[model samples]
Target: MADLVYYVAVTLDGYIADSDHKLDWLMAFPLGDDATPYDDFYRTVGAVIMGAETYSWILENSPEAWPYANVPAFIVTHRSLSIPEGKNITLVQGAASMVAAQARMAAKGKDVWLVGGGKTAALFAEADELQRLFITQIPVVIGAGIPLLPVSKVLNLKPVTQKVLKSGAVELVCDVVVG
Candidate 1:
């Protein structure tokens, strides 16, 4: 079975994005490595899941034409969203477990990327479906913003890998000890 990995960038204070849901703060960081961590991770991911807002944000902001053309993407949303032509992106609304199951099926033994804002990621974590978490800790502190993991409950994670990226970002890869 493929592990569900929560790959996300966060501020030092543990914020994923600003209140406006902007990742501009993360984009400005200097990536010193020639190889991108995302590219390597993307190869292992067959499916991606995110919240409605995160989906819309990527649609509006991503410079690429189709970032996940080959990967299946599931967006949890109540509101209708515009579909990008020739992309395998689906809008869904349901219990987190349902979404996780669908994503796992789509993954076909590959990994699932639980990508999103705090609340959406929290949903998977709460369901105990998210097995791994890769946190790119950028050296910044956003006083007020969307938290990295916003859950009423706590999930314990044990570090499997930790390294300082060429971009000066601290990457902490952890196995979900108890989700």
Candidate 2:
């Protein structure tokens, strides 16, 4: 069995993006030699699960050549969507449990990655489906925007690893202690 890891980048104030769904602040923080985490993740993770909004944001912001070209991705969306040809993108609707199940099945022997959108991550977090959270906090404050984690009763996490980069970015890898 593989664990579900939510690896995402966030601002100092815990915002993943601004109110307009713009990652301009995040754009300023370069990934310089920071591909190690993502590379390792893609290597170990067989599938990715993301919300429709996050998927749309990627499609709108990402390069012409999709980043997750080889790995399978499940996009949870309410509206109809089409997966680009030759790309391993699947569309699913309804609840988070169903999508998480689908992602687990698709993951095979490798881990499952819960990518992007604070609400989507919160769903898995609330359900106690997510095991780990790898957050690379960029040094910037968006003031107000989409939070890195949705408002909830209470959530606890214990740090497992930490790393500081030359760009002043800090990465915290923690295990979720769901109650």
Candidate 3:
């Protein structure tokens, strides 16, 4: 049994990416010692999951190589897209719970990482599949952009830990309270 963690970085305004869906704003900030925390978290992830938009962004940005080639990558999308050859990637369509179950199985004993694009994460949260949220709050504020979690329903979270990184980013880890 592995926990499905929505580990992501968000701006002060609660946006994950800017209005253009660009992470350039986020890339501008240096992680400094914060890199260690991310490195430590990444080590616990056995499988990665992301929405179609996130997958497309990665394809366009890092065309040369797949970043999560070592782990099983699952992309949830309704549209047809071609995956790079020799990459450990799978295109899946359907409900969030189904997709999450697949990722959990692939993760084995390790945790499943719910990689970005707010709608996807919201779907999992709505389905009661998401277990944990590890949010790194960047100091900058983006006026308008993709929200962190765009759920209409209220989801209670219990704080697990909080830390202020060297780069001025505040990391907050919480457990998603489920009924």
Candidate 4:
């Protein structure tokens, strides 16, 4: 079975994006190298699960070619959104448990990446499908924006790994201790 990993770049104030659903602040931070420190961890990802808002945001912000071309990507959306031709994107509407099951199949024994939208990740967390959280915390505090996890849930995480980047960001990998 593939594990669901909610990997995100968050602000010190626990935000993934701004109020207007922009990541410009997060993107402005220097990454320093050609490849991020998370590259090794990302290499194991086989599929991606994201929310409708995240999907729409990516469509608006991403390059001409979809970034997750090879990776099987599933978008959780109740709205009737159109997927561009030649893109391998699947829109699903259902409970998180059902989506997680489908995501496992799509993952093909590799890890399933919980791509974006904190609310969507919260659904997975509530379903007990989220196994880990790899959060990269930037030094700056934006004060207000889209939260890290909109849905409230107590998570007892056991630290598995940690890394501090040259850009003054700290990345922490932890196993969610599901109780």
The lowest-lDDT stretch of 10 consecutive residues in candidate 3 is 31-40
**Which regions in candidate 3 have their CA more than 4 angstroms from the true location?**
none
Query: Best-fitting candidate, measured by TM-score?
Result: 3
Evaluation by lDDT, superior candidate among 1 and 3: 3
TM-scores for candidates 1 onward, in order: 0.93, 0.90, 0.96, 0.94
Q: Order the candidates by lDDT, highest first — what do you get?
A: 3, 4, 1, 2
lDDT of 1 by residue, 112-145 (tens): 9988878999888898888999888999888889
Please write out the lDDT profile of model 2 over residues 70-153, one tens digit for every residue. Answer: 778998778887677889998888677778888888889788899878998888888888889889899898799998889485
Question: What's the number of clashes in each of the models?
Answer: 0, 0, 0, 0
Candidate 3 residue lDDT tens string, 69-136 = 88999999889989998988999999888898899899989999999789999999999999999998
Model 2: residues >4 Å from true position, as ranges?
A: 31-37
Model 3 lDDT on a 0 to 1 scale:
0.91
CA lDDT of 153 in candidate 3? 91
Model 1 poorest ten-residue lDDT run: 29-38
C-alpha lDDT of residue 131 in model 1 = 94
| lDDT leader | 3
Q: Which ten residues in a row have the lowest lDDT in candidate 4?
A: 30-39
